[model samples]
Target chain A: MRVSAPVRATVQRLTLPFLIFMSALLAVLGKADVLLFDRVRVVLADVLAPVLQVAGEPIASVSRAVGTVENVITVYHQNQELKLENQRLLQWQEVARRLQSENEELRNLVKFAPQGAVSSVAAQVIADSGGAFLHNILVNVGSREGVARGQPAMTGDGLVGRVIEVGGRTARILLLTDINSHIPVAIEGTHDHAMLNGDNSDEPRLVYVQPKTPVKSGDRIVTSGSGGMFPPDLPVGVVASVGGVIRVETYADLARLEMVRIVNYGLDGILPDGWVPTPQAGRRSHARAASSP
Target chain B: MPYSRNRDYVGFVARMVPGTTTFLFTLLSLLPFPVPSFGSIAPSFALMAVFHWTVYRPDLLPPGAVFVAGLLLDLLNGTPYVGLSALALLLVRTAVLNQRRIFSHRPFSVLWLGFFGATAGAFALEWAFVSLMQVEFLAPRPFVFQTLITAACFPIGSYVLALAHRAMPALSA
Candidate 1:
């Protein structure tokens, strides 16, 4: 009743080619957003999240231990630097206080109800998108924590990325350095706007700047809230360099991210969730704005 | 003698050890370690496992296992472009299987050299496919670094797999 060895060999020979075809088909399906493929991904993420969390804990602990040792070695230098930095910060604090009061007076005169405070949920990164071609991480917080697709994920340092997929208990964040990431941001001093595009590189590139825009190296960058994909004025990073091309050195040392805040600024007016503009709606909005003015 | 069949059944289940262990190793390899400029240095520990098993235990480690491993990695990594590492891993397995006649009895250095060839081919295919998808020339540095690092990691992986092989009970052919 045993199968023939020749038949088994033929099946083995066909296996590789069939898999190759399936792989390409899956890729195309994934790219095309085929519903079944998408569901498989979500289910896979839900299944893998727990295993990743358990595995990541040991590595995170070991790294924390190593950081402790390194910190001890540099404590003296750090202390001296902190003292010098504190002196400069005190001077800046005086200027900041004056500006704060002046801004408040201006807002009161205009009857501005300044934007409501944004609430955020903190989550730990349980898994990393490990391939060099990709930059994403799965976090423990998800829909149950009020997490949603398009919510911004960040650390104390700066903007990390936006949530691409939200599961019941886990979510996947598309990192700033991911090739698909395209963020509209502004330079602090020059106020020149540019799109930050990740090319799967360490430093994401700043593209679409006006050639005449006076952008310099080391300029600070923040989200401009232009398209409302993210909250305005979130600290992004410094313009790392402005040679032939502009590069951003993100404030969130992406590799070191352990926990992140998923912020819901709630003013996503420009591209609000579920607000698809059909031709009729676009015309109606145009007429309304014109008549109101 | 009657207990021999039960022991044989145990051997059949034991054969699954390498695949499960290799799958776990693949998952662990994907775990993030926060280090500067270490993003591209994700050594293909999983690639090494595939090569080791395909060469040493071809019958035991089948193509389905490789495809599932690759598919899961693709799904997890979110690279619709790498189509996941599934196609790449299978190609490597096929290449290694073809070279088994020459590689099975070879020395460690020769095996490492063979891995270099397979890695180069895999990287080339990956780079070409990714570039075609983008319709622009994507930088090859990350892929190159990954190839070099993964290739460098081959010996350590092979050593570990060899140990795992020794520790498992022998299969009755």
Candidate 2:
């Protein structure tokens, strides 16, 4: 297996350029034909899920320790804040009780049909894309845990994002701040609909707003259920700014996500598996859906 | 003969240390760090590994290995552009190879400074490629932030690679 000096040198000289050219080609064409990459990514992610979880254990404990220390230092101040919050919540509870009875009576009068049961699974964040241009998290739960694509992932505070890629034991969540994310949302109270678009920033921009209602800073945004991808009225975020690009500050702390609930609202707005057999076709349909105003 | 075989085995593992560490570093970059806003701008540990090895032991971690490491990173991170990392890393290796003389036998600060330059180049290339693909000028703030973060974290990444490099003396080169 001995090679001549000229031949070996030629091969060595060409290797770098060849690989660079190949990579450039792949980068340009990868999005158009993502089926191969998707399969490889899912398998690789599933295989490495345990490793990521185990590696993240120390980080999780360290953050928890930091949180504990902070809580201890601020316990007295927190107690005062909690007491006032409790009093306010109690008043709301009384109001909610009255509304519940009135709503029940109205529902009986209208013979309204009850909504179906919603199912959800809790998943731990295992991996982060960690790229400047990407805002996705890989959770340690997937199809085996009943996780499905297009299901909303939320923290108790609010919507985090949606499950886009699901493996057997891992699912990747496209956070609300990812460039490709486009969730249909509405301003609270006004019910004026807009699209929440991610630009790889901490705050996602609110676009396609109804000109009739002026969006103001501090106005709440929630899922509009327009595209059927998400149910109506799931808490999203508050409008951080109204001028130039309307930005939303998500209620869920997407930056420090620990756990997310991927809930199946029983909505089938996403195309079924049979409709788009290939992953590329599925991605094209998704692109079309996201592009539509 | 048995003793020689044992020596060969040890030497083989020693040679593998660089490639193994690069792969591990790629995996390390993907681990979910609980720090606020850390995930989107996690330091490029894989690039650090490639840079370290390209400067110290380019023969062991060849272009092929670097390409595979980048591919593994892109696949594991779930980036839509499958080869962007590979391209960036290969370019880094090529650039580092040319300037290896400057880093060789230099103090830690010089290596760190060189790494900073490499980080800037890699991130700028990414920003340009992505903005071009997207057909709009992307906000450059994150790319700048990531470059600084990656450069700032180089000492740690380089220290880890140095520890692995210590085993290279055992290799039968």
Clashing pairs in 2: none
Number of the predicted model whose DockQ against the real structure is largest: 2
A39-75: candidate 1 lDDT, tens digit per residue: 5767887888889888888889999999899999999
lDDT tens digits, residues B1-173, model 1?
A: 86898888877767877798778878877677776545456777778888888888887778889888887777776665535578888889988988798887778888999988888788778778777765667788888888898899888888888988886766534
Report iRMS values in order: 4.3, 2.8
Task: Supply DockQ values for each candidate.
Answer: 0.51, 0.65
What are the per-residue Cα lDDT tens digits for candidate 2 across A1-293? 99999999999999989999999999888887777888788898999899888888988899899999999999999999999999999999999999999999999999999988899999999999999989999999999988888889999999999887889999999899888777888889988777888888899998878777789999999998876889999999999988799999999999998889999988886645422123344346446545665
Question: How much is the lDDT of residue A277 in candidate 1?
Answer: 17
Interface RMSD of 2: 2.8
Best by TM-score: 2
Q: Model 2 over residues B1-118: C-alpha lDDT tens digits?
A: 9989988988898989989999999989988887888887899999999999999999999999999999999888878889999999999999999999999898999999999999
Per lDDT, the best of the predicted structures is: 2
